[model samples]
Target: MALEKFMKIKETLLGVDIGYDSVKIVALRKGNGFHQLRSSNIIAIPPKSLQQKSADLDKIAEAINTARKTARPRISEKLAVSGLPESKVFTKIIQVPQMTDEELKTAVPNEAARHIPLSLDEIYLDWQKLGENSKNSFDVLVVAAPKFLVENYLVLFKKVNLELIAIETKGIAASRSIIKKGEENTIIILDIGAEATGISIFDLGSIKFSYTIPHGGNTLTKSIAAALKMTNEEAEKLK
Candidate 1:
């Protein structure tokens, strides 16, 4: 597993949002309906090309601690590591015949093989059943991330000494927060994040399809930077 090294959990959770212009870290002492948001802030990245492999794990860890100190000066512990959008992640919902838990258990891997191009051994596959009553067939939400990506993320998390409970997408979190249901109608949710925009269509709370496009606010910033001959920071401020 990617988190095998850094999986030793410490605090509650440290939600790290790696934006194009800035790296934002949020420390949340979660509550029932809300969280204290113990600490939160944005840290500027080095002034250079910020593609993959450009970020230094040590510096990112330092920034997380710095942001926490700036927001809540008395915080004492490191939190769990969060995940970014990995390219290998594939999300889908397929309907299978109703069966017992034992049957579904056996069927999921087989279904994964039919859908996933690579062997199940090459990837970490996770799935959830969305309950019955979707026209008699069971609906399942599935996610697959390449082992390499997971490993890279865990390496960074371990460097920061933050235990990772789960790796999730901001798009999923956004849907959980901002979506408004109207009589169980199908809807497509689009979140224009700094680096990417996600499109997820859900019919009555079940995902039909989910996709992420490379172009986003970051793309716009880069375009503005190139056109206006300005730095990414300047172009981002113009946004």
Candidate 2:
């Protein structure tokens, strides 16, 4: 999941966030010691476009392309990064006997099967060594995503001609982007999206837990519309 380590430093990086309600794109230029936002855009998706059993990849891809074009007329760097929804990704922190990197490579896969509910064949696995504990055990952060879900992302990015350099969990991306330094005390982050809400517990400079609720802003809007006998659009504006 942390594919950024393998990427060559680029002048600009494109961020693509494909949500249930909208496709968002942002271009950032790396500066001397900071990043400058070049341009950004958001395009709404058709209602229930992503909630169906089989999503319409074509329409989703089209929305992403439109957002990219509107975000920046011509982004020089095609390298991009995207996030998998918190609900679709599985993450766990496990303790293992301290071992060399080579040994952990083989050990992690065997260990992951116990922590992750899905079969090994159904997921793409990745891991990072956190640090050693007092008991001489290493804490490793394991991440996995369903193969089909990841393939859809690849296909969508292919259709839009952006090189997907990395795919991170939404919680990781949010913490990295917004959490300030020296604020390492345990804190909860609530990401309220249109169709879902992501709750993440961040502490010691990493995410300890992440959960998603199916209800979000759209659900509230629907409730308001029903109670007031107003249109969804009107309720949305009022909200």
Candidate 3:
């Protein structure tokens, strides 16, 4: 559907990506069978707040409020979807001998024991089949997360009455936006952010490898600030 011809609805969805030094919101309108682009913007959040065990919900609310105000025509939507950073996520690709869909029901626990460090009861686990293997085996990527981190984020959503549709790790969201289906394989997508840079390796329309570099532009700016005796802003400008 064309952008202007898309459905218009009273509902607006705010997508907030909590970054190290800021919170960004890509406000979207939920139309019939689709979402229409309203407006998108970002706001700088206070430091050390997002790093805590619990994020300050007030700050998140404020950032969304700001972005909504800045967009023209104004937005009346309050529902928001938040994204989780990838650093805390634990993921692994596992290959098992040819097994039917029914066979996996019985074999997952055993396979999980060999691959996951925590007992099955200790973690919230999820897995999806990628495709079939050469020898009639199955290829699956198992994802697990600490219960505490998951709950910590849930609290943020509750504070503002913003419904949480789904929480996705940073790598997964970036891959969806950056990687194209049936495109040339072996292409690398690099996204440079404030505290880290994500390196995703796409192969055969799937993300095969995802890595993050601890060193980012901010790190280099900090290095320059300390070495050259300048303020952070000056160091960043020089860089």
Q: Which residue pairs clash in candidate 1? A: none
Compared with the true structure, what per-residue lDDT tens digits does model 2 show for residues 60-83?
988877776666555545889988
Q: Which stretches of candidate 2 lie over 4 Å from their true place?
A: 1-8, 47-54, 72-76
Per-residue lDDT of model 3, residues 148-236, tens digit only: 66676677667656776667667766666567767775778776777777776767766566667866789999999999999999999
**Model 3's TM-score against the true structure:** 0.78
Which window of 10 residues has the lowest lDDT sum in candidate 2?
A: 1-10
lDDT of 1 by residue, 46-155 (tens): 53212355456666667766766777544445656454563336777777888887888788888878887778887777888888746667887777777666666677
After superposing candidate 1, which stretches have Cα over 4 Å from the reference? Answer: 1-12, 19-22, 30-33, 45-56, 72-81, 133-136, 180-187, 225-233
Candidate 3 Cα errors over 4 Å, as ranges:
1-12, 30-36, 69-73, 102-106, 113-122, 226-229
Better of 1 and 3 by TM-score: 3
Residue-level error in angstroms, candidate 3, position 94: 1.3
**Candidates ranked by lDDT:** 2, 3, 1
Give all candidates' CA lDDT scores: 0.67, 0.82, 0.69
The collision pairs in model 2 are none
Ranking by TM-score: 2, 3, 1
State each model's C-alpha RMSD to the native. Answer: 5.3, 2.7, 4.6
